[model samples]
Target: MDMKKDYDLLRERAELLKVLGHPVRLCIVRGLLNEGEKNVGDMQECLEIPQSTVSQHLAILKSAGIIDNSRQKTENYYHISSPLAKELIEVLFK
Candidate 1:
């Protein structure tokens, strides 16, 4: 086994876990998975958190490639983009 390759894979997985470890981020990810695609307004309302807070968590998830968004007119609808994240959320809720 190539130690460097293994280490790189571990690091990537660790980073994904770290990104999902936050309560707000976890909620956002889970919400996206369960509710399909949603915009900042929708998530803010569901989470009962400030729009800014939701956007901040979204930025983190987006940076980690855990979620991706599509633009429809004026709003951006976000959805889960990582299969690993989807499975993790399902296991967590189960």
Candidate 2:
């Protein structure tokens, strides 16, 4: 592969890493990975964090395109948005 193309891909990966750098965001991602789709309340309960804090981290993850949300009744469900995120989280445990 071309070095330029490799560098570009690495840069993009770095951007992703930066987005996932926050402890709260990492915990949110890990929760989503383990539980599949979950609402903000569910994450808050599982992580033992404040609801607003959970929402803040979820928003960050959503903005980074690392997770997607769907509305079910009065609750919003979230799940991993990209296979790359799943892979990276998996690698973190290995």
User: Candidate 2's residue-wise lDDT over 1-94, tens digit each?
Assistant: 7999999999989989998898888888888898789998888888898999889888888888899999999989999987998899999966
Candidate 1 per-residue C-alpha lDDT over 1-94 given as tens digits, one digit per residue, 9 for 90 to 100? 9999999999999999999999999999999988899999999999999999999999999999999999999999999999999999999999
Q: What residue runs in model 2 are displaced by over 4 Å at the alpha carbon?
A: 1-4
For model 1, the stretches where C-alpha displacement exceeds 4 angstroms are: none
Q: Where's the lowest-lDDT run of ten residues in candidate 1?
A: 26-35
Per-candidate clashes come to: 0, 0
Indicate the residue-level lDDT of 66 in model 1.
Answer: 99
TM-score of 1: 0.96
Which residue pairs collide in model 2, if any? none
Task: Quote each prediction's TM-score.
Answer: 0.96, 0.89
TM-score of 2: 0.89
